[model samples]
Target: MTDEADPKGLIRESYRIEGISTGECRSIFVDWALSLGPAMTPPAAIALLIARYAAANPGHPMNAVLSDGLEAPPEARRRGGRAARVAG
Candidate 1:
């Protein structure tokens, strides 16, 4: 049976790949994230993923990507534009 954090096994298969790059792991992670059910939150899912795989596969690239997922997102900033130049 599949785990709720990885119902489709995308993360599991990603770890099995030989020489999987961080970029590739990132891609697989996106798919995995989108596939998560509404009941799951990203951080909780990522924590589960790490707990499930990290000890046995410490060097796996997916681990780094998963950790990155838990970090707070960067501040959103608007670049210069017509709106920025205009005053209300």
Candidate 2:
């Protein structure tokens, strides 16, 4: 979402936070993505967030980090007594 209509300020704050590591920002990004409404999918949210901040905040670490996170494959997990790999 755009800064003007950012409801939670999570994206805006992410760009402004000082000395935040890529890992820390990634954790916060996951939380923010999860907290979004059911209607908003993770990929869509990531795209919106990238659009909102990437160009304007070019120097922000999140720009590259967020893109990398989106491209990374989902983690594997065990379910129903069997190991299952999540399809990205």
Candidate 3:
């Protein structure tokens, strides 16, 4: 699997990163999710990530943060550029 699709390294690295806050990790995770190829779904990816990291790194701050992110509803996309007029 591509590095982007797999959360193992990312999770571990996030912990090793000095001064990396949960909020920063959340943003990183979002970027990682958006970079995924078409074959993967965000929900499925999130579930897998939780299963792997949450179990192994249960005490890690990212576990709870990532779990909450998974539970939260996806944000609505803001229409802009050519779609701005149509959105209004």
Better of 2 and 3 by TM-score: 2
Off by over 4 Å in 3: 1-4, 7-9, 72-88
lDDT of 1 by residue, 1-88 (tens): 7578888999999989999999999999999988998778889999988998989998999999999999999999986888888985
Write model 3 residue lDDT over 1-88, tens digit each, in one string.
5554454466557766766777888877766766666776777776777876777665767777777867867889977788777745
Better of 2 and 3 by lDDT: 2
Candidate 2: residue pairs that collide: none
TM-score leader: 1
CA-lDDT, candidates in order: 0.91, 0.72, 0.70
TM-score of each: 0.86, 0.66, 0.62
lDDT ranking of the models: 1, 2, 3
* Number of clashing residue pairs, candidate 2: 0
lDDT of 2 by residue, 42-73 (tens): 67777887887899987778887678757869
